[model samples]
Target chain A: METLLSPVVLFFLLGAMATLIRSDLAIPETIGKAMSLYLMAAIGLKGGVEVSQAGFTPDLVLAALAGLALSFLLPVPVFFLLRSIGRLDGTNAAAVAAHYGSVSVVTFVTGVEVLTGRGMAPAGYMVAVLALMETPAIISGLLLASRSGGQALQARGKLLHETLANGSVVLLVGSFLIGLIAGKPGFEPIAPVFEGAFRGILCLFLLDMGLIAARRLRETRSLTPVLMVLAIVFALMNGLIGVLVGAGLGLDAGSVAALGVLAGSASYIAVPAAMRLALPQADPGLYLGMSLAVTFPFNILIGIPIYAAVAEMVAR
Target chain B: MTSRVANKTRLDILVDRPLLSVVTDILHDTRVTGHTVLPALEGEGAHGPWYEDQISGSQRKVMVICVAEPDTADRVLTLLQPLLDSHGIVVMTSQVGVVRGSKFA
Candidate 1:
């Protein structure tokens, strides 16, 4: 209930409702994009500062390795399930699976905000975890596509390039490195721009996102019950895995919830673009609608609280 | 003072990177011998302005232009319509005065 009433949630709701009502409300495209970049940089710098304070630890490396493994491995099952149950073709399955294997930075950022609101914070090194998880899922999705047939092999070069050079991966990892090199003094100079302005920018971005989501939902009428069930189940299972991993790493309830949110979220920005390049035959409507319209809203509105409760139980 | 000349066909297509091959394959199937591709920086769509930094590294839009005979354009557009139905594509056909009608045809 408290989570539902948070300023972030309320703002998101306000934006969504306003957009749905066809209000003349919008954020300029460039401003929305700049906000996204600023948010990424701010989080990366904060994570770096925290990492600086904590120093190098074995747990950090282990967590990163585990995250990579999960990213690479999770998509295989998801691909098969989408193919068999959802009746999606090879391209669509691969595209959707890649999304499941990847993480959403926005969700991770929201998790951090939630934790902060509750007076609990995770180690800044988790930003590294977020960055590490971005690319492996793409590689996994590509591998799944290749295994489907020989025709996909011809596009291997393009696939590899897209996966490696994807935007989210570049910004997240690049900003993290910048934070690490700059440390505290460096972060302080830019804090006013990146940190202070983040919340206001995020509100604007969320407004744009709300409009995008509503439009997608309006266009998609064929997202059947079976797929909806699958989306919900996968989201729940994904969150559970994150909770377990966070607990094993000795994270508290709030931190565990944050990790869960990170794991459960799917990429609309990065993976969809890569899929368009790597899996042209794939139905964008199916995967894009699923990720952006279905999974994203579920995680933001409902999954966060459920994860938090689960984390509390486990911690207790 | 304008004289009627043989009309040549022009085709323009805009697509994402993944579908580039599929589009090329359509061209190949239609026996298109030559074409030019230009990169799109960014633009708005049903989803909004697809930022280059959002998805794949290339984050580019490609515009494929081909000038061919009327018969070839008709065949190519028929094949292309479905592939591009869910995706973004623009096809335009305009009459061009061919100086060397035999070679173009």
Candidate 2:
């Protein structure tokens, strides 16, 4: 309940409500994009600073391995389930499955804020874990597509370059490096922008996300009832898998919850772009509608707290 | 009173920004002299309404315009045929009059 009432979450709900009511409230596209960039950079830098303070640990390596494993494997079941239960084709099932296996940066950032407020702040190196988890699913999804035998495996060879060199990945990994290089004393100068103003800016970003997600819900015709139901199902199931892995690895409760958050969150940004290029025949409406409209809102609104509770249960 | 003009085929391809390269590659492969790519602000199609937004990196559309000889335009269309439905590449062709036919050809 407290998580739902947080200012950031509240702003998201407000944006969604404003859209649903057809209110004239709007954020300019450029500004919304800028806010997203800011949030990414801020999150990356903070994570880096925290890592620098803690120094490298064996646990970090364990978490990275866990993240990579989840990213590579989570899509297999999702691919089959989407084919059978959701009644989707091989191409689309692969596309949507790739998304469920990947991570959403915004959702993780939101998780950090909520978890910190609850005094369960995840370890800083989890940022690296978040970054590592972003792209492996693309490869996994492509492999699944290959099995379908329908030119669903066509890789124009641009996917690897694009996925790795994507703007979000570049900014995140780059900023994290910079943060690591410039430890606490070096970060003092910019703390005002990255730390002091973090929550306020997050509120702005979530407001824009709310509008986008809600509008996507309204405008997209690709979402069938089964796809919609499966979106939530994927979040819960994937999220629990993450929680279990994190707890089994003996990570802190906050870190375990963060893992769950990352696992549960779907990629509307990076993976969607890759899907558009790699799986051109796949419907954007189905993938985007499922990730952006259904899963995103559910995670921010309710899944965060649930994951935290589960982490506490299992990790303790 | 009017300047002399030559008949040409104008191809305007509307495709998502990411796939713009694929479309351009087809034009290049077809030997179209040159083309102009314009950022599309907003429009609606069989899928739905789309507009420019930097975040998702997918919805933004670009209009690639190439005026060329009929043969060149035909080759471009032929190359783009497979992608038209699969990639949502919208190619519009019309007979047009160009003042500098040699420039486009």
Candidate 3:
């Protein structure tokens, strides 16, 4: 209830409403990109600063391992589901599966905001986990696609570039390193920009997201009722699996929920680019429609709160 | 002014951001004198409406323009032919006059 009413989520709803009504509300493309970059850097720096203060811990290591494992393996089941239940072919199924397996930075950022507001802030090291979880799913998805000979975008040089050297990964990792090096004293000066203005910026970004998502849903011709149901199901099932894994690993309530959020979220940014490049034969309308239009909004409106509640229950 | 300009082939490509490199490499491989890449804002196609989505970049597109000799343009076309249907790449070639056709060659 709190999250749904919050200005961040409300702005998102407003954006969607504006688009749905054809009110011509739009955020410029460059501005939207800039906001996303800023959010990534802020998340990274804050995580790094917190980690620097807390230093290394066993839980952090465990979280990282679990995150990597989940990212690498989650796509397998998703591929099968997409193939059988979703009635998609090998290449398309593999493409969509990669998206479900990967984490959404925006979704994680929103989850952290809600969790923090609820007074259950996840450990800072989870940012590292967030970064780690971004790319390995691409490897899994590609392997699945290649079995069906969807290897158009399989040049290792290009794959490495897309995975490691993409703008988001670089900004997140670089900002984290800067924060780790600077520590508390170094962070004090930039606190106003990064810490003070964080929520407002997030609200603006989510507004753009809402606009993009709603507009996409309206424009897409590829999504069906069954596929839409599968999108929600993937989020819930994967989220539950994430919570279970996090709890088994002895993560805190916040971290466990954060894991659920990450697990539940689908990658619209990084994975789509990779899939488009690697699986050009795959339908962008299907993958993009599922991830950006359906799953993204669902996760924002319902999935986050559900994961938070589950984390609370499991933690107790 | 018309007579002052020499005859050349103008090649324009509407390409997704991811494959911009592949197209440009074809340009390089075909040895087009030079090409300019521009961001495409919003457009509709057989797929649907698309805009310059920088975040996901799947919907984003670029317009690559090159003025080249006819032979060079033909070579570029042949190289990119395989990707046209599969990649949704659209290439347009038109005959145009340039002030420096020598430069294009």
Candidate 4:
């Protein structure tokens, strides 16, 4: 309940409600995009700075590999469920699967805020894990999609280019590197933009995200009841898997919670760009609706707190 | 005084921005000489109303316009048919008059 009332989450709820009520409120496109970029850079810089402070550790390596494993493997079960239960075709199933396997950055930021509020901040190096987890799911999704046996698989070269050059990936990894190099003294000059204003920008960004997701919910036609149920189920299962992996790797309680949130959240930004290029036939309404509308809200409202509780229990 | 008018096909495609490259590739492969792409501000469709002002770029649309010779337009359409079928895109073509058909060619 406290999590839901946080200013950022409340702003998100307000945006969703405004859209639901047909209010005329809206943010400009460029500003919203800029806000997203700001959030990414801030998180990356913070992570790099934290890693610098903590020094290199074996645990970071294990956490990273765990992230990679989760990213690559999570989609297999999702693809099968979508095919066997949801009765979706191979292409659509794969597209939606990719979304589940990848992480949502905004959700990650939200988890950090929520946990920090509770006096349990995750390790900064987990930001690197977040970046690492973005692309493997795309590869896993494409490989699964190829089994359907068509020209869709022929774009392997192009898909590789798109995945590597994706704006989110480039910006995130680049910013992290800059943070790593600059360390504390280097980050000092830009702290105001990247640090002081992070929460305010996050509120703005989430508000816009709320509007987008709610509007999409209104327009979504392809998310059938079975798929809807699966969205929630998949999130819970994936989040639990993430928690186990994090614990197995000996992560701290906060880090474990962060991992769970990363695993539980679905990609709405990076994966969709790749899917549109590689799986054009897949219905946007199905994947976008499931990820942005169903899974995203579920994670924010319920999954975060549940994961945090689980992490606390396991750590004790 | 009269102005010269030559027949040309105008192709208009409203598609997601990220896939604009794929659409443009099809046009280039079909031998189109020139095209224009405009950012879509907002609109309604099977997925309801959407605007460019969202945090995620998935829902944003771009409008690509191409004026080309009839045969070139036909070829472009042929290549784009499968993509159009698969993606949530709107493609329309109409008979248009151009002052310089050679430019389009």
Candidate 5:
């Protein structure tokens, strides 16, 4: 309840309600973009600082491997589920599955904040884990969509390039490295913008996110109820699986929660760009609606607490 | 003094940003010498409305404009029609007059 009532989540709720009730409130495009960049940089920098203090360890390696395996393997089940139970074609199923398999940075950030608010700090190396998990599902998705042979093979090179060059990946990884090099000395100069005002900026960003999500929900006419239910189911199952893996690997409580969040959260940014190039025939309405509209809001409101609890239980 | 003008076809294609390269490549292959691509701020279509600054490039739209001779325009249009049908793209062509026809070569 406390987590739900946090200022950030409240702002998100406010934005969502305003949109649902047809209010004219909106965050300007440039402002929203600036906030997004700020948040990504702040989180990356913090991660870098943490990593600098801790240095590379065997646990970090294990976490990265777990993230990669989760990213690459999760989609196979999702693809089959969508094909058989959801009754979607290969292209649409693969597209949706790719989304489920990849991580949502916003959700990851929010989960970290929630855990931190409770006095548990996740490992800084989790940021590297986040970056590593972005692309493999795209490869799996394309292969599934291609089946025998087609344009998929020819476009693989270009799609790989596009995926790597996505702005989100560049910003997160670049900011992390900058943070690593800058170390403790560098954090002082930028503390005013990146550290002091981090939460306020996140509030404003989530407000905008809420508005956009509500709009997307309205725009989604193509999703069936079965698929809708599966959105929640996928998050639950994937999140549990991720937490189990993290606990099994002997990670701390906070890092375990972060892992759960990453596994549960679907990609709305990087995967979508890759899919646009690799699976052009797939409907954006279905994948975007499921990821942005359904899964995003769910994780924000309900999934975070449950995952945190599960993480605590496993750590205990 | 009057400026010299010659007939040409102005091809405009609105496509998702990720596919802009593929569209431009088709123009290159179809013998279009020059083209300009502009980012679209916002618009509504079959997939509903979208904005350029939505923080996701997958659904963001870009407008590709090129002036070409009729033959080149026809070839580009024929090739892109299938893509337009499959993807969320809008393609249109209008007759226009260019100052120097050779410049579009």
Candidate 6:
């Protein structure tokens, strides 16, 4: 109950309600983009600082590899299931597959906040893990789509370019490297700006996100029951996989919950743009609504606690 | 003496998924050979910026560019009107010199 009433969750609910009520509220695009950059930089710098303190270990490497593997493999089952249940043709299933396979940075960031609020902190290297997990699922999703019916976009080279150069990937990886090089002393100068403003900015971004989600939900008339069930199941399975992997890696409860959030959250920013250019035939509403409207809210509001409890049990 | 040569007709169409095949079939039925479909990134219509990531099997806008004889364009537009009644499409015609009149018509 206390967790549910936290400022972060409350602000998110406020935003969601504001948007649903058709309030004239909005976060400026420029500010939103800047907030995104700030969050990435802050996470990277903090992670770098932690890495400096702890030193790089094999466990870090293993966790990263596991994250990559989950990102690559999770979508295959999702694609197949979507095919059977939704009766989605091959191309559409593959496009949707890519979405589930990828991690949502925003959700991961929210998890970090939830953990931090509870006075629990995850290892900094998780930032790099988050960065690494972004692209593999995309590749796998495209591959699955192509193999299913060979209707994959012919602009392979362009699609590769878009995936690699997507804004989120560049900002995330770049910030991680900056933190790696800058270390603690370097991060100190920018800490006041990046660290201090994070929560307020997150509130703003969540508000916009809420608006987008509400707008997406308006199109729910088109969603079938099968797709809805598939989305919920996939979200749950995704969270479960993250818990198992994080536990196997010997992560603590908070860290494990954060990881679960990462795995369960689908990419709305990066994957949607890539899909637009690559899989134009696939329905956007299905993928976007499932990720944004269904999975995102569920993770933020409910999945976090469930995962947190599961993490505690496993860690014990 | 040069009589007024028939103008070239341009057809632009934005359609959802299920209707894409039908639109293409219309073109095929008309024997209009060459057309290009461009992907729509974001836009506002009856629904706000149609987020492609939201709806199931929903349609994204595709810009289909076709150049044909005025008569053929007229026929195609006439055929497409009913289809576009429920959806969205734009049609326009302009006078232009065709390098090969026979090939175009």
Candidate 3 DockQ, CA atoms: 0.85
Candidate 4: count of backbone clashes, pairs at least 3 residues apart or interchain? 0
lDDT of 2 by residue, A52-163 (tens): 9999999899999999999989999999999999998888899999998899999999999999999999999999999999999988988888787635544467777889
Give the per-residue Cα lDDT of candidate 5 at A181. Answer: 90
Which consecutive 10 residues in model 1 chain A have the weakest lDDT in total? Answer: A149-158
Q: Tell me the TM-score of candidate 1's A chain.
A: 0.93
Question: lDDT of all the models against the reference?
Answer: 0.74, 0.90, 0.90, 0.88, 0.87, 0.75
Please write out the lDDT profile of model 6 over residues A171-220, one tens digit for every residue: 88887777778788888898888788888777777766676677677655
| Highest-TM-score candidate | 3
Arrange candidates by TM-score, descending: 3, 2, 5, 4, 1, 6
Q: Residues B31-87, candidate 2: write the lDDT tens digits.
A: 788999998888888988776756787777889999999988888888989889989
lDDT by residue (A1-316, candidate 3, tens digit) is 8999988889999999999999988888889999999999999999999999999999999999999999999999999898889999888999999999899999999999988999999999999999988999998998888876655554568767888887788888899888889998999999999999999999999999999999999989999898999999999999989998999888999999999999999999988888777778788889889988998999999999999998888864
lDDT of 5 by residue, A1-316 (tens): 9999999899999999999999999888778878888888898998888898889899999999999999998998998899999999888999999998899988998898898998776899999999988888888788787872424543667887888887788989999898889888988898888889998889999999999888888767778999889888889889888999999999999999899999999999899888888888888889988898889999999998888999998884
Better of 3 and 5 by lDDT: 3
- The runs of at least 3 residues in candidate 2 whose Cα sits more than 4 Å from the true structure, single-residue gaps closed, are none
True contacts kept of each: 0.21, 0.65, 0.84, 0.65, 0.74, 0.02
What's the interface RMS deviation of candidate 6?
8.3
lDDT of 1 by residue, A1-316 (tens): 7877876766777777776788878665566677777788788878887787778787678667767887787788888998899987776778788998888777778777776776666667889988888878887887787777613633567667867886667887888888788888888888888788877776666666666666566666547778877777777888888877877777666667777777787877777777776666666667777777778777878887787778877853
**Fnat measured on candidate 3:** 0.84
Deviation from native of the Cα of residue A179 in model 6, angstroms:
0.8
What is the C-alpha DockQ of each candidate?
0.23, 0.73, 0.85, 0.61, 0.70, 0.09
Q: Evaluated with DockQ, which candidate comes out highest?
A: 3
* Candidates sorted by DockQ, best first: 3, 2, 5, 4, 1, 6
